[model samples]
Target: MKPKCISKLKITGTKRILQISLPSRKCKSIRVSPLESRLNTGCANSPKNSSSPLRNEQNNQKFISRYIARVLAKPEFQNKKRPIKTAATHRRTNSDGSKEPLSARNNKLSGGKSSCKNSDSDEKTIKKGLGIPNPDIQKTICRELSKKKLYKTNDTDEIIREKLIEAITLSFKTTNSAPNTSIDFYKLGKQIGNGAFGKVSLAQNRLTGHKVAIKIIDKSFIKDERTRRKIFQEVFIMKKLNHRNIIRLLEVFESNKNVMIVLEYAGGGDLLQIIKARGRLTEDECRGIFYQLIEAVKACHNMGIIHRDIKLDNILLTSDYTDIKLCDFGVSRFAKAGEKVDEQCGTPAYLAPEIIADLGYEPFYVDIWSMGVLLYAMLSASVPFKAKNLHDLHKLILRGKYDVPEYFSAEASDLLNKMLNPVPHMRISLEDMKLHAWYNGFVPENILDLSFNVTRQNEILSKMMSYGFPRDYVIQSLNLKDVNHASATYSLLDLESSYNYT
Candidate 1:
């Protein structure tokens, strides 16, 4: 009385379901119901129950169920194999007393799929596993992780995986490799310099044992949007400038009250301090320092940047005075092609004649003029044009009344004359100045290595010519810094007595 149609059996709760199939030549079960085969063969007949008749219907059903149970109990039926258990069937209880499948729990915690609701438990696990002592930092990490969405089997999952790995590594390193607190990274030393915006302090990195100057700026002092934008621009520009002669901005950290900028320390102080200490530099010393300055300026100009304020105070020297790094890009601006910046900024003595006129001028021309003034101050220990008031100073600069001392060599005086040209169009360009005899084969290593935005350069040059200077003279002056046959160098007394306008 064994049922031949049942090929498989499954139990769920209190019910048992049987899979019916027909036997094939290989003795394997084929899943085809008798009703379907009869319909396909065009036999229009309904299925009939095949059970023994009894006096009571309940008794008959009970007899049929017992008969099937007896067949299932046979040795042949009991020897049949069953399906294997999957990985998801393996469940585990977390330390928090919640039961979850092992696979799902691993995916949730390791894949960063845990939400804010579960962040507390995850943080406990992280702290217990990694031994992180700082509860505040642990909370921070958990909070950041909670903000991320659940991971999926896609690109986002990879990102989440990477973030999880980074968080774990950072936490471990923070606890084991370095100090437990962020403040321990650096030790504050003496106050080095102060300005209207911030104060610079010398600090030593506890881990690397390197000294750096930290510029701490109070956020409250930046009252206006313009000033805030300038601060951002200074940081952005400093980060982009990767030249050896430009001071490196190592890192920037912002908090609720202040913004701290880590910078390379210049132990020898600024050029102004050197000038004040030594009165004037030797020709060889001046040439070496000025060459580095020219290279720095050239690098800035090539990147379409203009340091509106360039002076001795803004130039810094290394401990040995072997090199200089141009710093203080607070007034720097990106001068695009064909653009004429009309901002009347910069030191009065260093300001170009056009800038003093309150008229639009090429910023590169202004930089060159400032460099000329710097060169003069470095060699003569005095500014070329000095007056009691801004009005007299502007007048002197407009009249081209700068003087060259008798001690200056012919090449130095010639370079000064070209750089100090009254007209912005006639001022020698950085390219020609690099080739001047005063430089004496001292070509900048990065001169040709740098790239320029040609469109921006063309725009600036075109706009510069529109400012009342002959186009031909502008081009010629920019190209003729190496030309030996120009004009005789003016003496201090001669320029002081004259009142020329051109």
Candidate 2:
């Protein structure tokens, strides 16, 4: 029998308990790890390391409780060593011939291929003078791992083991403690891009040397609570999404003054720059890009999300220019089938006719309309409807008076007309758009196959624990939706695995 889908699985806390519903086991695994809180989060597949059977509700709750207890207990990280003082400072050459000092812990994490389940669990002794754990020690270690710095890589051997050694020595004194994660952890690089809210910068993880884009939104730039909520909403929606076509939000940190978001580095830049540089692209090339865009939109709509703003500027291309990722969810929101929402937003040129007419519009159809505008712009290098002012633009959009470029083929024109239909009811559905003859020979590459890798999830769970994060912290963070260190590391690890290493 397939793992049954159950609702109301609650993880309780001091304030209130958070609940998550597991999808049916027969359902395909998603791009997200099994431990996430997404719609298709994970199956009820029992943990492989556990011998006790999760055959009923009580057992399932017990598993969650134990997991939570393990994490929330926030136990101090313990390290067991067998006299490696001399070996600690000795630099060893890798097979590649580069030499770097590797700590005993680094060997378990980076040198060897041991799975996380067995990595951090070996018993270690507290020194004769100290047996009681210092409560702050756990936070200090966890904070170091959760910083808003570069996404950590496999360069564990490079981490300053001196502090780790100090902590180990602290085992001899009282419980050991280290500083919380700080900006010092990142090797800051040049500014890369800018947005309405903040500037983007490039940074490399000091340990692994991996590059990441950090978007820092200053509190002063935020005008009001509504704008602040929109930014938070973007983070929320991005967290729920785990598709290849969408940019991964690796980690998030909000301070009293600024909101910092770490994202995948897309060196290829946005679609607007590409469209401007290339001008009018060939029909074949446009179809290729559109395929991915449509797939991204489909993925969002599947999760009942509407990317209220879909335009050339919002589509990000990969460094290789081989793939595109949809981004900028500042105006997105959830909607049900046939549900209508009103709140005139989105770029002027991409607004649907219903929106221009002040009629409450179905969110899905509005997104489809914007996509039509995008497709038109992709083909002609400009929006179909244009005017000197908002009044004139609204008029042109409501009348649907834009002419199809003479260069467009009949099939392309036909599809565009259906998409640009003034009658909202007549707009082509996503299914019809896929079947449209304009894309007769188009094929998408690297199609995502959802296979919930519980092992990978366990591996991450173990890795976090090894770094001093309690397992319960990860689960609780996901449940509470706190965009903090434990959840960030899990998402970062999952994002790393998400990329095609080949």
Candidate 3:
């Protein structure tokens, strides 16, 4: 500064530092060796290090500078440090075959709601916090979580499929593309419900104001060519099927990439949600619902469509509980005129022992097995076999091991045991089921027509939830205002004996 100092710039990578200038204008760069300084300081007791403190400090600085440069110059370590790809950062397909942007639906900062952007900084935080070990279970769980959040409160069509897809992704790898088309087939709205393939969205027909549930499918997940062909086969089967108990397919549209299936919308939700909200059913109410369920299954078998997937979720109520519809033909297989299939498909929990054993059992037998589980769940609010893993579940199913709680009546136990027999030949036929002791008292051979009526159906739902459910569990599950009124389907004085379970 005494004589205007001239500084020279030294460059490292893209960064430049100014070097101090001497009186002669000779610039001297003060470079520090972070590693070398530590090594020299630690080696102070060496014989060659005998020097004055100031001299030693000056020599140590020079040594440290060289050490840092030597370490920095190593190519192997530098080459090994590649950027990592994280699961959370990737875009994944939802259950309904839609690719959702990778971000949480809800974002709030200090109670202020806003769309939060996913950033590298957020990735850094995740890397630091979640030191997830590379184990198979952890990897599987992560893989599922990456596609969609485990649980979501949103009922939006896209988000619902996302959640359901995430739930089942571990077991099933769903595809993520819809049929591409020029025509506006339907405008998808909020999610109506979930099915085996993906989800059903309440879509409006663009041309007409008529509303329909559009089933979305991601083409990428079709996997094998046979599976893809099976999808078309299912569509063909659904086309021919027509009945009151079955949800009808209105139209079919396809683009190069996806198939858009249009189906009638059931305003009321599924039987599972109703039973979950209510709890248990009375004998008459149980009989009523059971009769409808059996009739629906019978109808499918009659049409040569073996409904591979038949559970509480597949049976939906028509606004009023009177009209019940069996849906989700995704897993259904059509047998020849009188032929029965032996495919290992249907849900594990509901799988008949013969199907699990691969013993070439009839498709209708699997339906009966699932019905048994359905009946058990209706009577007791739980499935017959509850195991930790699918293998154990199959073992229990094959062993024909299921415990009917003391709370269940002996008649119910007898019925469940009859239908749940592991041997396909031993299992009771649907026709024989119609004549069971529990249903012996009901009038008119056409129990289905009588049960399908609006007044009788509601009475059954109310009584089943009221009498069958444990009071405390029923109230908690349903969020009921009055437990009594909630269970009250109709006046007991004028009530038909068709609903009395005991």
Candidate 4:
């Protein structure tokens, strides 16, 4: 029989609380309360160490709890231990029909090695049984573990590493805290990435089992009313905007200092990653990606939301390279019908001439100008307006005088010139962009039959992994001193002239 939250089971001679991880794999072991107690503390009492059975059991439980905490907290362990709960712990029975030793399970987990054999328990067991007797201890352990689960760890470097390992072991000791597939709604899995604000985790929806990304933002960094309001506005904007080409926001969860924003996880990572791996994106691929992006931007314009920060970094790719999703709405603004925005905020490299001039202009035009910059970056794997200092960059942007590279096609050049027009009134509108020659026949004839070659995608991903865009485009363009190459003489003008427009 499987463990339940309130179920009583006899393990050896003790009647213990058995809780199964509901809706999880059957082969997974159910943690008794005794085990939970052990994992909470670092020490586990072994047969060699414990003089009496009662004392031994207590030590073992404590050790196990600490061990669990260590394992669950690790990056690698987080991947192995999922949060889903299932009714069956389909323990493989030997011909003799005896239960398998814990070592066997531990070996499997450690890939055939007993790495954590010796441990001390949090509480001394009364006898050789898997049971919980003291209600007070049980309640304490349960509350603490749940609290830890709820609170995202904000430990330092060394502490994070140690705690992760302990957490993994603790996870298996009790099933009460197991993430319910039905209740959790989303299959919360491993931590994919982290940033200054918080982390991005991979999650799967229980209903569809589709992998998604969950970004948990730390509340500590969001200190002021400006930030709180910004977060709320972002959530509101994401809730309203819906498009295939845009990074779809599924849900927003506000818990403590952790604000979890659930989104469609892009397995292929971000365009910036792709570009970093590859010196430059292929012309055809760039065209297709830009075409989709413009359409998405047009949709945003139609919805009255201005994605102020449009760049390669904000674009994420699907597992297959066929689709790209625009993400990171931190600087996005919602304009009321017939209203325009003058707030100047966005990435410096992608800011429009009007923004540089500090002149009030329709925010949508700023988006269009940024789109042009994005296109240039996609095609050449470098920003068009590059300089050493912000002052020079601002001057260049105000002039809007970067020469289009010779590698650019006629159609791309024309589109670039039109979209990047310095005058806000002259920039292409969302309506006109859709009707442009470059995008005229780009719409899908059938949504489901979109062409996506897996082989090509693999090649692209592989190439991206090894090579992409240049990292120091801004630094290099300005001819700044490379910290490592103080004595090396490099000519910036010569390098620029090498790729001069005909």
Report the lDDT tens digits of candidate 3 across residue range 155-215: 5545553433333333322322111122232456887544334555776643233455777
Q: Ranking under lDDT, best-scoring first?
A: 2, 1, 4, 3
TM-score of every model versus the real structure: 0.55, 0.62, 0.51, 0.52
| Candidate with the greatest lDDT versus the true structure | 2
Order the numbered candidates by TM-score, best leading. 2, 1, 4, 3
Q: Is candidate 2 or candidate 3 better by lDDT?
A: 2
Which prediction has more favorable TM-score, 1 or 3?
1
TM-score of model 3 relative to the true fold? 0.51
Model 4 alpha-carbon drift over 4 Å, by segment: 1-190, 206-208, 337-340, 439-443, 449-502
Q: Indicate the residue-level lDDT of 286 in model 3.
A: 66
> 290-372 in candidate 1: lDDT tens per residue?
77777788788777677766666678765534457788775566665345654445555666666544434555667877888
Model 4 C-alpha lDDT per residue in residues 288-321, reported as the tens digit of each score: 6776776677778677677766766677765545
lDDT of all the models against the reference? 0.50, 0.53, 0.47, 0.47
Q: How many backbone overlaps does candidate 4 show?
A: 68
* Candidate no. 2 TM-score: 0.62
Candidate 1 vs 3: which has more lDDT: 1
Q: Which residue runs of candidate 2 sit more than 4 Å off their true CA positions?
A: 1-182, 446-450, 454-482
